[model samples]
Target: MNLPGHFHQAQYPKRARWFMAIVWALITVKCGVVWWAMPHWNMPTHPIWVVGPTLIFATLVTILWLAHREE
Candidate 1:
């Protein structure tokens, strides 16, 4: 027995799941990069400065990718 038809229209959950997956992947990859860079990070005086912009760039790219797909 089926319920109301409108219940199936909310696609927010699907998008949310995708968004969460992307976030997790991004975090995991980002951590890996930082881990690999740990030695250089210790040597460079301005290392934190480098990672900040890179993270912003990567996040924007992921945002664009997801936004276009959902449309």
Candidate 2:
């Protein structure tokens, strides 16, 4: 059986796209720093606990953004 999907043509503003890209890049860099520094610090919490969600969300958003059609 084929299910109907709602597909709307949307255009993301250039400024917004650039802003999001910068934000995502910053988050990724922060995560990387945390990953590297976790071993040096005597922190109780694991690095994954702090960085995993951010990375996952950023990755998902990036993927969705890339998949979007710009026309």
Candidate 3:
């Protein structure tokens, strides 16, 4: 028997988008925390090691989230 049409087309996309949004929000919040916490290391070149990874991670996460958006 054929299932409901909206299940495959509309609701699926909405659910996927919702999950993706939550994951992205979590990642953003984590980045925010790291941005402030990194400096406490008291190292002279802390930015090079800590800030660099934070930026790279945020960029990669943003790209992945944007690329796999639901239609």
TM-score for each model: 0.41, 0.61, 0.47
Query: Can you write out model 2's per-residue Cα lDDT over 1-71, one digit (the tens) per residue?
Result: 22225433345577877898799789989999998888778788889988999889888876676566644
Per-residue lDDT over 1-71 for candidate 1, one digit per residue giving the tens place of the 0 to 100 score: 22333433254478766776887687768766775687665755454565677777777865554454242
Q: Please report how far candidate 1 places residue 48 from its true position, in Å.
A: 14
Decreasing TM-score order of the candidates: 2, 3, 1
lDDT, residue 11, candidate 2: 53
Q: Name the weakest run of 10 consecutive residues (lDDT summed) in model 3.
A: 1-10
lDDT of each: 0.61, 0.76, 0.60
Highest lDDT against the true fold, candidate = 2
Q: How well does model 2 score by local distance difference test? A: 0.76
Off by over 4 Å in 1: 1-12, 41-71
Ranking by lDDT: 2, 1, 3
lDDT value, residue 21 of candidate 3: 76
